[model samples]
Target: MMDENDVKELISSYKNIKDRVEIISNKFDRHNVKLVAVSKTKPTEMIRILYDKGHRHFGENYIQELVSKSEELSELNEIKWHFIGSIQSNKSKILTSVKNLYVVETVENKKILDKLAKSLLNNEENNNNNNNNNNKKLNIMIQVNTSGEESKSGCKPEECLDLVKHCLEDNNCKNSLNFLGLMTIGNPNATPDQPDFKCLVDCKNNISKQLNIPLDSIELSMGMSHDFEPAIEFGSTSVRVGSAIFGERDYSNKK
Candidate 1:
């Protein structure tokens, strides 16, 4: 675990970020924006330290790593886990099994959605029979390819309406997979002051209007370690931050 001093530094960093959130909130007039500290690649010990320091929500990119961390920190009830990475269909069960997992941000296909819906339904049924409190519906955010990158995994802006319609219409899938909002990653070449992030905001507005869905219910999950300020300014409800909170990451070394 991080030393008390390091934990204090981390908390200080978060406070700075929160202050930035306040500035952004004033510009946008939205005060409900939540900062999801991205803790992916950090050790469980560091996670524990941050948890103790008042950060209850975290975002993870890898399924295996997140599952391991979740198991290690099972004692902490207030931690709200968010899976902000691309998810494969084969890993849906593992993702769904995470205790107190509140959000999955990279949902683009029906196969993965079906797996999650089925798993949630099964868990709900099991919970009903055994009166288990552990079972809960998994919230999902449909990813949008605002950058139009070939490598990114998100539904196209034009295609999102159809997908949302299909997801809402499917009886087995609708209730189990709660569509909380939309998520997107910024293009590497895009500037923070430019329209790159605005595209996502525009997309959210158009989709919400087209579908006649409540805009408030649809969260815009964008931004990251580098450009979260601009993201917040663009009216993002939740921002996923990683290296900024955890310091520099050495991807070559993994324990």
Candidate 2:
């Protein structure tokens, strides 16, 4: 039910925040920092409006909603959907099969990663059988619990390096998934020199050094609407921002 007025308003709000994000990123020489507009509880109409306006990267925190939105927006060929939610093991198949899903940014364990990779490999086989040769590998980021928050969903900081190694070296993952980088939902009240953010940076550094991977090749997805600027300042290559652009979510009717 989003009309022209709603569309225009959404675009306006999106541009305002996007501009600020870019300014901060550029100030830190992070010119390639990506803004994944979190569209979790928002409608497909809202997503369509932004897609029509040339916004390609959108994120969702719920798997069902993400799959529904991707299906609805499949006609938009260039749209990129980032799954920023906590993935359930049983739902990996459904998540991997989403059309135009660019990346899953919350991969926490080998079990989930293996499930996702297997599902993606199956998708490849299905596409091959259907004569569709454009089966692209899915991108995945290792989620790190930098703040050691019990409520947060991610692997502990000490365990992140091994996970990254597994994602990079696992045979099935090598063929079916692209190890994109690291993602984290930092502690809310932390300051600019946020410990959570710094821990992610350290994790990336250790991975790069120990795994003999280049630092530049490994990206960091560590910011949300509230702390993206500082996250960017601490070398975040991607930020997931909601609310600031689409306004606060009404979770009463959440999917």
Candidate 3:
């Protein structure tokens, strides 16, 4: 329902945020920090506008909405959809069925991980049967509840290592799921020196050493529209931003 003026504003806002992220990344000597434009309630036309402008990475927080958008935008071959919301156990099959689903950034337990891996295997087999042989493994990140908030959907900081080990070593998961990194939703009121961010950073470092992988290999997906600048400085490789780029969401109509 965005008019031409709304479209213009969206693009301008997106570009401004993108440029700011790049500037902060450059200032801190961090390169390749991905800006996942969080498009949960936004319309596909707005997404397509950004897509046409060469912004391929988009994130959705709800499974049904994500599936719809992925299908609607299926023609855009290079689109990378990041699912940043909580994963329900029964929804794994429907979620993995989504085409161009680049990563699921809210994996917190072995159950969800196993289900996703199985779904990915089935999807790959289906693709092979159809002579479509691009068998790319889906990327997954462990969500660490660094702030210890009961409302957040992530594993405790201490539990992350074991979960990550299971992800890397389990036969079902290793084959279809790529252990990309750790993700977190920190305390909303915390400042730049938020201990939640530091806790997540520690989780990444511990996982890297315990698993014998390089530090850079484990991406930290922290930060949002509010504190992305500090997040980049705190070694966040991927930031999920929503309202800053798309304007405030009108959640009234959402069920």
Q: Residue by residue across 13-68, what tens digits does model 3's lDDT show?
A: 99999999999999999999999999989889989999999999999998999998
List TM-score per model, in order: 0.92, 0.96, 0.97
lDDT of model 2, residue 14: 94
Q: Clashes in model 3: which pairs?
A: none
Clashing pairs in 2: none
lDDT of each: 0.82, 0.90, 0.92
Off by over 4 Å in 1: 133-135, 253-255
Error of 2 at 193 (Å): 1.8
- Give model 1's clash tally: 0
87 Cα displacement, candidate 1 (Å): 0.9
What CA root-mean-square deviation does each model show from the true structure? 2.0, 1.2, 1.2
lDDT of 3 at 191: 63
Q: Lowest-lDDT window of 10 residues in candidate 3? A: 246-255
**Winner by TM-score between candidate 3 and candidate 1:** 3
Q: lDDT tens string, model 1, 1-255?
A: 567798788777777887887788888887788889888778877778778878788988889888988999999999999998888888887888898898998888777778888878877888889988665457888888988889988988877777677678788688787788888998867865647578777877887898898778789988887887778878788988877777888766442
